[model samples]
Target chain A: MASIKDVAKEAGVSVATVSRVMNNRGYISKETRRKVEKAMEAIDYHPNQIARALQRSQSYFIGIIVPDSNHPFFSDLIKYVEMRANEKNYKLLICNSLEDPEKEANYISMLRQNQVDGIIMCSHTMNIESYKKVTFPIVSFDRFISPNIPCVGSDNFRGGELATEHLIQSGCKRLLHISGPLDLDILSNRRRDAFVITCMKYGVAYDIIEGAHNKLTFDYFWSFITEKLSPEELHKYDGIFCSNDIVAYALYIYAQQQGLQVPEQLKIIGYDNHSFTRMLQNPKLTTIMQPSDRIGSMLTNTLIQMIEAEEDDPHVNNTTVDVTLIKGDTT
Target chain B: MASIKDVAKEAGVSVATVSRVMNNRGYISKETRRKVEKAMEAIDYHPNQIARALQRSQSYFIGIIVPDSNHPFFSDLIKYVEMRANEKNYKLLICNSLEDPEKEANYISMLRQNQVDGIIMCSHTMNIESYKKVTFPIVSFDRFISPNIPCVGSDNFRGGELATEHLIQSGCKRLLHISGPLDLDILSNRRRDAFVITCMKYGVAYDIIEGAHNKLTFDYFWSFITEKLSPEELHKYDGIFCSNDIVAYALYIYAQQQGLQVPEQLKIIGYDNHSFTRMLQNPKLTTIMQPSDRIGSMLTNTLIQMIEAEEDDPHVNNTTVDVTLIKGDTT
Candidate 1:
């Protein structure tokens, strides 16, 4: 628990000399710097970071806000962002919003008060006004808050078109699209829009079914799909596109429990090529591969650039990554 | 953007009084507190957290270190921990070690320098010496570094025994166990120990396939599984137990791709009943449920207690949670 003053005293130098040595700021004689360094090593004195942040009026930290860290999509994104941030010598502060607006607001205020260099927001529930008022640079992921804020996401519309086209080409006469909560105008909505357009183009009659709720729960999905389609109605659709892999997997399980044959009776496709999709017992989940790692790396890179420049640029606000269709056994 | 001086000038109080009022410290009249509050509201002044932390010599922040956030198990654990920590008015700083000892050490140093009140470490590669040297209270999840450090994990031995017993009861005479990296002496090793003992008690022949390489990749798993079991040898075993859901999922997919009938030809069981396990197309994954959320909440609660206590207790170093065998289509 040695303080900077203790190191300075031991090194026979003023506190300012020790501070300069620690920050590599102000000029100090080589001998004096060496003495200060030796004293620091002897006492195992790690400089007080809070004090340094106060002196500089900035913390070289970035805060990331996500709805749920457990979701594979967000976790994958977080991993890539952390990797890129580390490469740039930036520390990360993570906040799990749990899809609560109040929690998201609290975290936003906390990040602001801490004077974080930048923020990467992936949470969907916070008020847009709150983000507009943020003094620090923010890069929104997937969700678009305002034209003034920067956002990075995959081309959801194209992903939807690709998935639908693949299903149609596979000889699916009727299609069903299982969508997430329609409130947030993000990639999910874009995908749904594209699904409708693609189906119309293929001259296929398509029906849209919203999962009971926004949260991807197995119970909710099971009930939603079962209640929406009877055995007779189920026979009509040959293909199903789910908003995400979780829903697709749920449909697969529920359909099997209900004694329905897969691929012969129904083909399933999912969004987000999550790790779990490959683990499906059927080994057949054709999915849209959103470049989660690339988005994360790009978000971090963009935020770091803004931090270094110390300004916001509306011109570089919306960046979209390409999404590819990963064809598996289902198609 | 408004500074304390502006608020003080508007409130008709000294800068020191305004500072004290903002922090809710020092003796101040009720009228003065109200006046400062009103001034702060009118000016939209947010206190600088770095300055407050420096003055207090402690940041009300906790650091979390994990191998990879992308893993479902870790991501789920992190979510619960973050939720509980937020409830307790503590912010979280996350560091992903990516299973690199050097990166782990560097993160620990950074966490220490940040003056975080405590740290919850789930990284296995972190050096034990570094743990001993940390000045802050640390609560380890899923991994034990030393006898003195507090560790919170599920009863891995019991989990392993239950999984093995379930497989044996399901008419499996021979079994194969796939494990994670063994050098870390983590819960996986404890599970392996119990698996051996349980197999011995039941007079069931079991073979263990070690996939404990530093890098866990598809190639490593594919090669290891293929090399360990020739087609004739594979047919002899009726059950497989995996250390984690990820490995089990990989085994399931590889087996199916190789034309092995699941549950009929190979009954598979995985630990950490992840969200994706049940979502598989065939739902052929019966696994052990580790109560990840409970583990996360308990670890945070214990860490908070240790951080707030006047003196540390040596007896509260090891805490264990119960695990349950989740019956699914695989068994």
Candidate 2:
């Protein structure tokens, strides 16, 4: 059977373009659409799976498992994914696993039993063997679940490099990096790996703090950071990079309490420059901007393709989207 | 069949306690549980609907419609509701209508056709007549759909009175109130109404600016508020009330940009002390604390009862949770 890759090769365009053509997503020029269609015809692209989906009584439901929708990052992810799913006339079955391995496993089985058209795994807490046993069409966010299962996420390594390099260039000799828990071998861990590599390359002294964040209250974050930063220890680092914005805000508050003026005494950069940061954070937090909206759209589109095509051609979609550095008041 | 009210009376407890017993939610003294169970038995409380639900091939799906989960408030609500639903083994089907009436209507119909166990309507955009036509077991957040369908919400009028009173007590002669769009006759609008009443009672000057919020970006909020408060207009109000924390944050940013000191120069109060405000908000945003966690639990319990009973008894749940005043640096 001809794959989306075959269609892309025949169309003389990228797989994303071919997938876009197939999904009717984004602004595909008429010329490009026509070319993609012609290429599909020439390559005898596999019979339309949409028809098969309908014949099988498609549920029109896509299940998404995230660790916690309450976490700002995951909340944004859920919103974007839901928006895209809505656009495709699909509804999202949301599961917040709360980082429980059992809950994640249960959610996977429940999604399977429900016969959802496909599943999007944004929270990957289940064991690899458990994930591999899931026969449903699945795509993950930021985690490599299996070779055949697609993973969608931002270019975190690049994001880490940008944040670290920018902080270093901002005249910081010592740095602190705060990130989500490092136990999981997820793609986002690359951000930490890159942080270490970049710090070494730039000859900057850095310390790392990794903690499970989704379940912790902001009160916990405040007290914990306060405890970590003694009056003397507080001034140890001149710059900080947060894995996400909430932490950035926490540190910003911490610096204020310590009489450490932002940028003057401390410079902070957070990842995922959340929507609220644009206006809410005073002295905007300098951070890496993950395009959650695009990632969400692509995840939904990819899941739909996996469902329709029943094909596990991971290369059909370039799962990684670009991240950009946003200069805010903090740095 | 004995209604939950009947069981509550028999058990010498509130309906909420009976609901707690039935749903196995929250804390109930052993004596209370035993009393509730005995009352349920004596009163012949309707047969267990779990069995009926199973016999009918329960989808174990509860559809929740919000204008946009992207909004922080909705995101938090979604999180809490999803949490409770998960406790009960029900998965939430999330719909972000983006304040589109057509989308809301379509989602309602889709939910009905899918035979979801029930629906929690957090977004109310359709006509009341349309809502009355919905035969599905339905409960709403902050919007009264009809006389029979349950609506779960905070005591907005009380919330408003407290906020305005606090602002007035803080020695504010002039005040500004910011709220979500007033076009929809939703329960939250009572907050604005109470603001008006309280301000009038206090013999203080007040103004309200309402707009659709869920769909707008923080950038719009920043620029719009900036344009609203010109140099002369900025100094006009001594105190401001925001319908939600996001607007409060926006005004907070505005105050800082215009060099107006919070509390000292302009006291600001907002509603809905969201999960993030504990530490993320600087000087903290003095706001009304709407118990969203309790609200979510109540909403899920209400809908689950609606589904299990296949009955609509508006008095099954009290539906109104209390709000508290959280004093922060902003006020």
Two-chain DockQ for each candidate model: 0.55, 0.25
* lDDT, residue B207, model 2: 86
Output the number of the TM-score-best candidate. 1
CAPRI band of model 2?
acceptable
* Candidate 2 ranges with C-alpha deviation above 4 Å: A1-57, A310-318, B1-57, B310-318
Q: Model 1 over residues A1-331: C-alpha lDDT tens digits?
A: 8999999988988998898887767778899988998898788888767777777765778999988777777878888898898887688888988788988987888888887888999987866777888766899987888776788989989988998998898888899998877876666688889999999987999999765334535666667777876767766778999988877877777667666677777888999986555444454688999988899988998887777774445346578999998878766
Model 1, residue A103: C-alpha shift (Å): 1.7
- TM-score, one value per model: 0.86, 0.81
Global CA lDDT computed for model 1: 0.81
